[model samples]
Target: MPPSSSTTSARSSRRPRRRRPQGKPQQQPKRSLFDEVGVTAVDPAPFADLGLPARLVRALADNGMVEAFPIQAATIPDALTGRDVLGRGQTGSGKTLAFGLPLLAMQQGSARPLHPRSLVLVPTRELATQVTDSLKPLAKALGLYVREVVGGTSFNRQVDTLRRGVDVLVATPGRLADHVRQGTCVLSEVERTALDEADQMADMGFLPQVRELLDLVPADGQRLLFSATLDGDVDKLVDRYMTDPVVHSLAPPAASVDSMEHHQFLVSATDKQDVLARIAAREGRTIMFVRTKHHADRMAKKLRAAGVPAGALHGGKAQNARTRILDEFRSGATTTLVATNVAARGIHVDDVSLVVHVEPPADPKDYLHRAGRTARAGATGTVVTLVTDDQREAFRTMAAQAGVKAKTTAVRPEDAELARVTGAREPSGVSLVAPKQRETPRGRGANPRSAKRPDEPTRRRRPSERGHDDGRRGQASSGRGARRGNRGGARQA
Candidate 1:
């Protein structure tokens, strides 16, 4: 029983298409702003026309930033348009203002003592403080309030600040978690969330905490995630949380490392200590790198003894102690910091003019990280490594592998070139060795006459006694010879 073509089509049309069981229309999952819109780079001149308040524009102009950096130029418009952005840029590429300016512009008419409208999660306490400092002025100008919640600080104060409510909350994951656990701060009201240094957070193993924090924020809120690299767990984070994020990558990852000046000095074992001292005595703040915690402590002690205000940063230090030492270093109360690999990354301090490797690292990666302590935020810096004669080959290999073309030279305490390279005045009264005479034996072979019994005194014999002993020995030999002669004559007779 075959049906005609029209009858078959009529039957198919009459059959109901499976309808997705439609009670409440199955509320569609909220879409991210990036999913719904496309963003384009905009000039800073049009920010006012784009509806940013006049005061913020004046602040930007006063800061000598006439034009936005590439990251800012790319992401600011998207952020202002309430779109989620995933920004990829080098460390000093002005990503802060990329998100910061838009966050400010969006809060023009917000009332005083504002609730948590925006939240920024950072990896380290130092970074949290730095971000807070960078945003505080702008927040203040906008009649907005910002507060920092980081570890190694007063917990009660953070709770109090949260109770008072803040417009922008800058925090580290651990401390922010503590506040959340203590029921002090609420993330439900966070409309705009930013994860600054997302790669750093993953490196520090804070991704789980970051995930928990993100879960607390509203899913529909605008999100901005900035990182140097988007790989490994960071990529997973992006896939899970960020919706169709507009990725804006300004430069390659290693571009910043390429711009630094790396120099290695070949020094003798005896000269290494003096070379480090001279380098630390340079004009601006210098961070000397050592391989071990004990070495950092010892070097810091020696530098302080030599009249340089110095501090030590290493894993062995307590959190409060580390915080205090870093504070002193940043405030210029201490101009020199002797640290292990702990300060090689995630520490951002301005005006660090020099980085000295008292003991150069074995790996090229370590060398680059140590060198990165200086030359931050597009500022020029010098990195000097004091390599002993035996270590020159290894350091050279590391430099080559790290793509650092360093000027290699022999450095000594008195060399004016050392002073010129290091920007340090020669130490006035440094004595390498003690000025004292050492006694030596006159002859090469051990003196038989000098060998005496333990009971005998080791003093010089008197001149008369020496002469008498010699004469007695000569007479005895003559007497024995004469007796032998007489005996021979008698036998002949």
Candidate 2:
């Protein structure tokens, strides 16, 4: 029916009113980023009762993981449900499997070449290698292939492996960024992501690259972030990307301090070098930490000169050399290793009885990680910091911030406390002389340096030259004789 002009004008002026459907409810906003969310405690259970696949349970049983750690039992179920997670635990607390098993259980089919289904990001190459190695046996139980992508390895080999399918990839941020930039691997296909030691990555200034990689993954992809502490930049990461992630905080976030003992030794300036050498000369494996790379090299050289088998490890070394040195240290071929900050968090050598700080670390985190190198896996260890008069206050502040009570002792090179703490014996008087380097064979091998003939007299100097030498020697002798006479006269007077 045609309406009047006034009614039609009124109808055109009115806005269309929307109505809520009867069954649907009103939508609510997501929780605020800073709101305090309650964390759920893990239910007590074994791996079999935790809803893991029989095959994975068998693999866990094979690896002696019959019972779930608190972190695993708490995070696994939620992760399996495809939720983003923020997990916190101590250094040795079973984080690898807490994220790893769930990520593996979700991958049901073959992955496309250059497109992995899962990614694990670590801050260093050593950690990347270890993660890949640790997860490979577990991956094998599920018919998956795990690969490592790191900076020190051949890029071509990594590319080839990516061109062939990789089910799981454990990589450092820098190397993975290279693969993405080269178009060798597409990260958009990554579904499950885990960032191990996220705090260290932030401390290392890799958060930008981490953010870039996170952006490359699909928006719906699940993520798990694990760190010892979350503050500053790490907190920013959680706020921006994560959507209501379940936060799990475990006590004793850093390495356990119960198994560790700390000491600060005060040293005189003149005796510092001798004291360092004495401590480094200990019998069992000892890791020495210095502040700078140059210092690390110099300390290693000095230790070697003092008859201690020491190797220098720093970022300046090539990757192969670093690996070789670490292998030698682990094999007991090198008893002491002098390293900069690179080895503080990366090294995982077992049975390291002592750690010596040639200089105290700049911050508490550095201090804690340096001490954490020892006393691992429930083993006992001692950490000694060589403090001079000037550094005492700074070290005290650092220890306080790290929540440690370090014993301060005034010590000398010959002190018994050094032996009591480090098990260091008196250095053998003989320096560890380097074996003579082999010379490249010369043409026909004629006139070797060892061909000196004892019968042939050395060349004699001319009269003028001999006279000059005699005058110099006479001057030195006269000066010494005059000094001795003066001393005797002074004593008689």
TM-score, every prediction: 0.69, 0.77
Predicted structure 2, TM vs. truth:
0.77
TM-score of 1: 0.69
Model 1: per-residue Cα lDDT at residue 110: 48
Model 2 Cα lDDT, one tens digit per residue, 1-493: 8999999999999998978767867686444332244344565469887778899999989988798888888888888888999887655557888888888889879789999999998887667777887789988999999998776556677888998999989888877876787798899789889998888888877888888989998878898988766767788788877777977765443334688888999998898999988888888889999888799888888888888988888765555566777888999988998987777774688889898888888878888878878887558899899999999999888888888788889989888987787776777766775333332222122121111211111234599977886797699789989999999999999
Candidate 2, residue 453: CA error in Å?
A: 52
- Residue runs of model 1 more than 4 Å from their true location after superposition: 1-51, 62-66, 108-115, 255-259, 268-270, 291-294, 314-331, 340-348, 361-370, 376-378, 387-403, 410-417, 428-493
RMSD of 2: 20.6
Q: What is the lDDT of residue 165 in candidate 2?
A: 91
Residue pairs with clashing backbones, model 2: none
**Model 1: per-residue lDDT, tens digit, 1-493?**
8999999999988968888875776777554333334333433344444445688877766666566666777787778888889986555557777777777778644423324778888776556767787777877777888788765445565666777768888887776776676577878778888888787677667788889989999999888888766657788888888787777766444424555777777788887777777767666899998888899988877766666677888755544567678888889987889987667765788888888888778866567667777777668888888888788888878877766778887878778878887886644333222122332211222222321111011234699978986797589679979999999999999
Whole-model lDDT, candidate 2?
A: 0.79
Q: Which segments of model 2 are wrong by more than 4 Å?
A: 1-45, 252-256, 429-493
Query: Which candidate's lDDT is highest?
Result: 2
